[model samples]
Target: MPAPPPHSPTSEEDIRWMRRALHLAEQGQGAVEPNPMVGCVIVRDGQPIAEGFHQRFGGPHAERDAVANVPAGVSLAGTTWYVTLEPCCHTGKTPPCTEAVLAARPARVVVAMRDPFPKVDGGGLQQIRAAGIDVQVGVCQEQAEDLNAPYLKRVRSGRPWVIAKWAMTLDGRIATATGNSQWISGEASRAEVHRLRGRCDAVIVGGGTAEADNPTLNARPPGPRTPTRIVVSASGRLAVDSNLVQTIDQGPVQLFASADAAGLQPLVDAGVEVIQFDSDSPSDRLAMVLDHCGAANMTNVLVEGGGDLLGGLFDLDAIDEYHVFIAPRIVGGAAAVSPLGGQGRNKISDSPVFATPQVSRCGDDVYVTARRVSESPPKSVSFNP
Candidate 1:
């Protein structure tokens, strides 16, 4: 509506800028859970004049923030806007981003991927195109989708993306024969785990893990969001003095226990919401936990379950991603605990397969990341560009 800038119209340049937008989106990692992390970069004359990202939930969208970054007197009429996600056409917490873009009157818009949120699934692009503004999509689409995998999964499937994390020794032992386990991975890997918790809606674990580790599960240095701490137990046995229960005021704690389990008065009085499930089987209980998480609108779930609980989730094929941190040390003993426990797959073929793992180094630890091969979002909107 005001003044304008210019830029090269090459697809290669578009991709480079889109990647920049994607990088900006990462800034919203811990703050935007239910909402996808989106970033926008406005370029004029081959240079980025303004950029912004979805900073937090229920706040200004990336498009609005980016447009606001433009100097007060500058016009956006002829600029090319590169966004990691398609803007919205309908207003909810804030006005539709399409309204802002249309008012700014950008000459062309480049979107990395079409938004999958049903309310605006491709509608924003249609609205922009209808206004005679040129629109190009699918520029870094795979990257964009990867960045918002949890959000897309939740919106499309009504279930949170489940990520399982564990630390093990080279001997594949999670704990010593005595069940004493601590500091398996180096400091960096542990810190990364905290960062992972900050980005998720909840962190789930078996009751055994809750008692064994007595973990606080809060993000160190404090992230923008506090994830809910969940414990699943058939007997409803959580120590009232455990770190999770003692730190109730810092964050929310939830326990999924069997309907008949007892002696939870102290925990409930300490502000823990107890949800009862009818079944004692891990797979059945896991299903109920996920159902409750879905109903609560959770998008990403970080699982810190102990061996038996992890095994149950595996049996149910519930884990969507895996983060394994392998320490160089070897805690050798047949009696030592391994990463996965419970009834494992009878045959190798029945075991869940994952995409090729991504490996990285964290301090003295080797970190690996992989996702289930069977889990994928439904076909996305097709785009020619």
Candidate 2:
């Protein structure tokens, strides 16, 4: 099971300050992947003097940013520090955040939660305690965990958190008889999809969707980071003239295929990296792709594949979250494609149940998001950076 919120109930003032720090943490989204989004607030006399967030990967951490922002004349000797995550004790691209905190000489440190990274799991807290500074943990912890779900999952499970998304009609049809799926949702919903893509490390599609939609798969109104575009195919029949092949320079494109698949030379010649696996099973192939992603330290992966591909991931029980967009129009046809396709549940009771469903509106479309309910926490795994 996931660890319980550390420490006893904190004061309301602590919760309020931690909530503000979490909000600051959210500002680093779309820019800080592989690294957790963290925020820090330096408080003196119960009032915030300065605040900062982890702005980008391999740059200064939140603690350093906050400490640096403190006024030149103002001393940090007696101030209190509120941070969304525990400060780092190990150095990677930057120095240890514990060094900064020790140098700042804060009287007390309040953290929303502990860092799950193996190297810094409890090392950060230990360092501060050793320095004779008071540390209070677990204030607004659940909110902080939700904010950094992708990062936490990546560290604990050794794989990217997968988000399965689709846009369908009220009747649950993703496409008509002829597979013409243009404009299922309104303009606003499509824009929201672009924003979603901006936050993920990669966007994946099946060969069928790639062949049909010819999507550019780039985030519109461009985000801080460019997500890699991936196409999974068993036959390896991607067209060289397709938009993905033509725009290789705009963003990274990767093709995952089975060994001995046909017509791959054209794609390879077009500068697409072809990754081959021995397994032909959809579930097995998906596992290999996820392993590849995990090795690359990708924190969030968005799956926008067609019905069959989505069904395969569902069968494997690999998806962590679902984003469904429901349009008002009804496309009635027996041959139409629904959201999920392969080997559906045998009984209604056998279907997977989701938790904490959130519903909202995007113009004329209704957007729903929910996480897959799990009986136990993900098995802990080690991922060395």
The prediction achieving the highest TM-score against the true structure is 2
User: Residue-pair clashes per candidate, as listed?
Assistant: 6, 0
Q: In candidate 2, what are the lDDT values of residues 1-385, reduced to their tens digit?
A: 2232334346777777888889999999878889999999999887999999999998889999887788888888878899999999997999999999999888889998899899999999988888778888777776787788888888988889999999999999999999999989999999999999988889999999999999988898787778889999988857899999899997889999988998898888889999998786778899999889888889989999799889998888888899999999999999998988888888999888877799999999999999976666433322111
lDDT of 1 by residue, 1-385 (tens): 3322342344668878988999999999878767889999999988988999999999999999998899879889988999999999888888999999999988999988888788999999988887878888778887788888888778877888999999999999889998988989999999999889887889998999998889998888677778899999889978889999999888999998888888988889889999989776667778889888987989888998799888888777778899999999998888999988878889998887877899999999999999877545434534333
lDDT of 2 at 63: 93
Prediction 2 TM-score vs. true: 0.93
**TM-score versus the correct structure, for each prediction:** 0.92, 0.93
With candidate 1 superimposed using the best TM-score fit, by how many Å does residue 355's alpha carbon deviate from the native?
3.7
Candidate 1 deviation (Cα RMSD)? 3.7
Score candidate 1 by TM-score against the native. Answer: 0.92
Clash count for candidate 1 is 6
Q: What is the lDDT of residue 329 in candidate 2?
A: 94
Question: Among these predicted structures, which one has the highest lDDT?
Answer: 2
